[model samples]
Target: MANLYKLDILSPQGNIFSGNVKQATIPTTSGLITILAGHTSLITMVSKGDIEIMLEDNSVKSFTVIDGFLEVSDNVVSIISDFAMKSDDINDEVIEKAKKYAAEQKQKNDNVPSEIAEKNLQKAIMALKVLEHNKLKRKKRVKY
Candidate 1:
């Protein structure tokens, strides 16, 4: 049997995920780290990046998180993020719209463009990157 651990991810909106996972990879301020069934207790700041969760059945799930905190204790992992969403839930059309809005904001020639525009642009860029990476991963899986 594969070692399984508890994983719970929460965001301001609501609970994102809560279930058993074989392992999980998280992006922290120090970089990426993979936590297994018996990982030592840890508390770390989560950076904006991709988080991968592997289920006991070997299925993989991915999420993109903005900023958050992660804690691991007694085989349970908890994550609280300012923003988070499954990579599969990301919409390309939404990302493109964000980019276009940011560009329009910049074209306004405001010495310091709108903060909302910048944030939207950044999120859009990150989502796009994750999407691209997921595509590559899927392609690699198909080739094998």
Candidate 2:
């Protein structure tokens, strides 16, 4: 049997997910970090990215995460983020609209700070990436 780890993903609003997962990967400020059963303890800041969870049954769950910290200890992983969403909960049309809105924001950001505009663009791009990655995962599952 695979070792199971307790995972709690929380955002400011509330808990996003809490359960046992075989493994998880999250993006940190430095880079991507992958955690497995019995992983050593550590905490690090997170950036805008995806959190991939491998369920015990070999299925996968994913979340789009932004701005948080990841902690792992004694086979337990906790993610505290400012924003997060389950991949399944996100719709394609919503993401497309967000992309278009981001583009518009960029064009109309003449008075806005460059950093803010860049951040908006980055967030929109991350959303698009999450949708694409989840779609591919779902397709792979359907194939198998």
Candidate 3:
């Protein structure tokens, strides 16, 4: 069996996940980084993308996280993000709403701050990507 390490994911709303995981793939500013047991202690900035975790039972779970920071020390990984949500939590309704809002924001790009509009659009796009990835995973799991 693979060694497990503690992983805690947090957001302004509060703790999103806290438990042991065999492996974790985080979206860092540099790019996606995979951490296993006994990884070097370090800290880095996180980007907007999906976070994939391999649980003790080997089940894979995923979440979408916005800008944040990650710290790894003593076999414990902690992530603090502005926002995050489980893949399963992002349903079709939420995706549609985000898409509509993003389009509306883009249409008013001239009136709204470019940076804010861009950030909103990026977040909405990230959410959609996460949802699509989850759907593909589900499809692969369905045996004929």
lDDT of each: 0.88, 0.84, 0.89
lDDT of 3 by residue, 18-131 (tens): 999999999999989999999999999999888999999889899899899999999999999987888889988887887788789878657888877777777788888888
The per-prediction CA RMSD against the true structure, in angstroms, equals 2.7, 2.9, 2.2
Poorly placed runs, candidate 1 (over 4 Å)? 100-117, 141-144
What is the per-residue lDDT of model 2 for residues 1-144, given as tens digits with 9 covering 90 to 100?
A: 659889999988798999998889899999998888899999899988878899999888888887889888878889998778887777777677777877887787587778777766776777778778777978998999
Model 3 bad stretches (over 4 Å): 103-111
lDDT of 1 at 85: 88
Better by TM-score, candidate 3 or 1: 3
Error of 1 at 92 (Å): 1.2
Worst 10 residues of 1 by lDDT: 111-120
Clashing pairs in 3: none
Error of 3 at 80 (Å): 1.2
Query: Model 1, 1-144: lDDT tens per residue?
Result: 548989999998798899999999999999899999999999999999989999988999999998799999999899999788899887788678768877887787777546667676778899899889888988998999
Off by over 4 Å in 2: 100-111, 138-144
